[model samples]
Target: MMKSLTHRRLAELADVYGGLFHLKMGQLHMVAVSTPEMARQVLQTQDNLFSNRPATVAISYLTYDRADMAFAHYGPFWRHMRKICVTKVFSRKRAESWASVREEIDSFMKNVDARIGSSINIGEMVLGLTRDITYRAAFGSISEEGREEFLKIMQEFSKLFGEFNVVDFMPWLGWISYQGGNLHKRLDRARGSLDVFIDKIIDDHLEKKRNKKNNEGFDGLEEDMVDELMEFYDENGGTSNLGSAVGITRDNIKALIMDVMFGGTETVASAIEWAMAELMKSWDDLNKLQQELADVVGLDRKVHESDLDKLTYLKCVVKETLRLHPPIPLLLHEAATDTVVDGFKIPKRARVMINSWAIGRDKNAWDEPNVFKPSRFLEGGAPDFKGSNFEFIPFGSGRRSCPGMQLGLYALELTVANLCHCFNWTLPDGMKPYELDMNDVFGLTAPRAVPLVAIPSRRLT
Candidate 1:
């Protein structure tokens, strides 16, 4: 098997061998599902059977033994965590209460405006904005040094999570591979750093709770996620309401914090970077989107969340970017019991990988699968990112679909729209539009191999 560019290789293999195929990775039985029909069966029809996550060394060690919602086994604990995230963290009300998103974007645009006329790294700028916004949303306000350190740790965690360890596939060779590659040491170091950072944040939250308790009349303050989760912890008598379950512990809170930090930051940043890369290459689409923006939002003002709905073309561009470059190209699942999918027998504990990248590019599902056309989504019967349309699921479908979908889309659309609306972007050094490098560095999220450096001139009213 070709180890590098594994997702693309899987797409090519699926093209030759049809939608469903089986392979063996050491002692692991693996199934690759690429087409929409197969996706429906695994994600919707037999979702329960394939709902559990396959344990990986990096994920298990970094995420507190799969205590996080994303990697937790499909069971009561998962349900409990998912409920907390949906209701307390990512609820529509909670998303709306974070007015800091707008404030952060304003700061971002000011930084961009300051660098006008000179080439700037748009990828880095987008990453900075997302990281700041996510940090603020997760833990109110953080110092510059704290934010920088947290971002560094998250980067290392993402890199280590995506790494391929031989011990994952062949356990018998664990001692040799673990000692020779220092995989255990690396995982331990990353996990330890993250735990310490999150622990401090949690302690701060506890202190704030104590202060809030002391205050008699303090209704003006807004509760962040930690406050909400802490409230739940206090209300439930320090026990998770899920019967007979070990209550939500400090470790669980830290694990969920890890999820929010990594999930909210990396994926949204990658989407924005990819969208900019695509628009940079496709001039017509860029112009069309700008025209829509001008018509919807005048030149005197910045793009607001309220204005996003009227700018349909901008939404389509985001959808198109997601289709071409899904953050997580392959969604992971594990079979909980022996089952048959598309007439192929899948054994219990088999690892299932749904190649969303291939599904988006499937010839039968999309016309000109390789093209970067946003109009496809503007047609009368076009699909959406809500996961109902299997062919267009940038976020996975069914039970384990991303709980942060609404918040993520809000961030992606807002950032992309403002960048396109406020400035006319040009490649640095007069490079041709089509010459932009679209190569991707694959990991937990696939970001551009080359950071996008472009010149931005404020658009005239």
Candidate 2:
């Protein structure tokens, strides 16, 4: 399983065994859950006990020793961080307030226009678009040199996050990974690069705050995520009742910002890329979606966020795309304590892998599970992805569910809508729609195995 795609392999095993099965690998106790009922048992029924993440060596190092909310041990501090994320960072109001999103999208449109007649890598394009939006939102203004360097580091971070480390599974073989210091050296370099970049951001923010205090008419800069976090970092001498046992530190702030960047960028881009890929392969669905966008958004103007709700078909396409290609196929969680789930014994500290990709295609749950039919969702009584519908949680459910879901979904919907509404896309090099490769490369997120390349022609005047 370690040698191949873990989720696909686990799903294959589930087919022969059952929806739920256990495997003991070396010192690790592993359990794979593929059915909705079993998923509910773990994600909802025993959510608290299974809420904690099982961080690998890379995860712990990249996440600053579990300081970030995504991998933090489920506790008061996690709850506090989640509260801030909900109320401040990923809040609906904050998402709505982000003009940077529109600016970035407009810039992306301009880039797309520049190469309309030629083949372009849609996946790479969307990746850069989301990266810029995330950077601007998280840190207001930055040099392109800094942004590009940080992006390279983040790519390394993502690669390492999914890299195999023998130490995580068999602690007794710890020396194997450290024999050459290759993995440790990479982890140190990645985290060190982040520190240099983010530490300078923190210092700059502090200097600006100081200047504002000293100067009666100091030029105020718009607050970015760093500014927002500094309020908590400086609260009550850094000991605010934000739910932590101790005061927040620079590491905490940096970790939280990393969470925002990681959560926001590639995940959204991956979803958008998949949506485009699916649409490119299915012309009838593509035409229907484009028609809906045309009717609601109109060709004369770009699709706005306010116009999104009216573009129902566009939403359905997104749902169908996520159903087929969930950004994270395997939802990783660890058992906090020993307990029984669905009449089966679950040991404490056991690794629970929820095969959401398989669950999405469960024949019992979906009609023609392999088909990409957006109308399945357009019909009444469709399961929504907002946690209640276990059969359709592209974003997982319960406490460990994605907090930035609203923002990410907004980005996906808006980008897809604009891309489809403004342009007519076709496979490059005279390639047929059926020839477009939909196979994905699994990692932190499963993006396309081959980057999507297509030609665009303006559909609107």
Candidate 3:
């Protein structure tokens, strides 16, 4: 069966891993699992111990040893940091504060229109748009100023990290990747960028504070997560030391920004790419979708946030993308304390992999499991993504799940709808449609094995 594993080509994983099993990635023990009950029990029931994040040596070193929110476990400090995001930053009031998001959307459209009549790098382009949104929303800076330098450095770091890092499995050989000082060079670049961007933002905050310019007002930027993090940073004496008077550091806030920056950007871009690939695979699906878009949003206008409800078919396409190529396929949830499930003991600090990719296509859950059919979601039929059905979790469910589901969905809907409504895409240079490879080269975000290459012809608009 192990030998046949490679021969069968390792398609859907739920059928392969079953509930739990040990697979070897060299010396490391790789575990894969399926089922909503199991996921809930591990990530929710034992939320305390099981909410730990699998360590990131690269980011840990960058953050001066695991001070980042995404890398931190469930604890008082993490709680304090997360509150800044949940309450201060991403709160309804703050979201309203950043009304410029629509302006950014307009900027995105203008940029896309510039690429008309030419083959464009949609993947790279999407990253820039996401970065600009995040930078403005987080630090009130575009990704082009000194802050943009930090965004670019982190992007390079993530690109390298998205690759299979052999050192992750063999920590002893971590030096192999940095024999030429590559790791230090990247970390240095990131630190330099952070020094400039975050420092400038913080300085601006202090200046605003000195002038008392809306610093204490209800609608002021003080209610922002960045502002909260800075407040905590100042109260705590500028250190992430344990048992401090305040809570966390400025670096922790920046780390959270990086989390949204990477987690939010790559997945959104990949989802857009996957949606395009799947839609192209089925012309009938595209035409059906186009009719829906045309009815809801005529050719004279473009799809906006308000138009998302009418474009339900396009949403189905996004769901299927999550099914086939979930950005965080092996949703990482580390064990915080030892716990037992189904009479089996999971030791503390064990890495748990919710095989969402495999679960999405489980034959028991989906008909024609291997095929792409956006119509399956036409009715209220299959399990919704909330972990209720457990079969499809493009965004991992439970307490530690992605908090940016709405934001990610917004990017996905607007981008996919606009692309679909804006252009008729095709494989470039006479490439046969059937020859396109859909295989995935798994990464931090599972992306298409071959970059989805296509030409975009703008609509008559």
Best-fitting candidate, scored by TM-score: 2
- Number of residue pairs clashing in candidate 1, backbone atoms closer than 3 angstroms, sequence gap of 3 or more or interchain: 1
lDDT of 1 by residue, 47-166 (tens): 999989887888888887887788998988788889889988988888532576788888999999999999999888888888888888777753335888988888888788877777
Model 3 poorest 10 in a row by lDDT: 1-10
Whose lDDT is greatest here?
2
Give a tens-digit lDDT track for model 3, residues 1-461: 23322212333444565566545654554455666556666656666666777765565665546566667777766666566666665565665424545666678877878776676666667667766666666666322366546666777768545434456666677668553266667667766676667666677766665656654542344233466566666534434554444455566656776776776777777887788888877778888888888889988887777889877888788887778777777787776667776667776656777767766766766888778888888866656776555677878866567766776777777878887887777777777767778877666777777777677777746
- TM-scores vs. true structure, each candidate: 0.95, 0.95, 0.85
Global lDDT scores for all candidate models? 0.84, 0.85, 0.67
Off by over 4 Å in 1: 2-5, 95-97, 142-145, 177-181, 216-222, 234-241, 244-246
The true-versus-predicted C-alpha distance at residue 217 of model 1, in Å, is 9.0
Model 2, 311-391: lDDT tens digits are: 888889999999989878999999999999988999999999998999999999999998999999978899999898888
Ranking 1 against 3 by lDDT, winner: 1
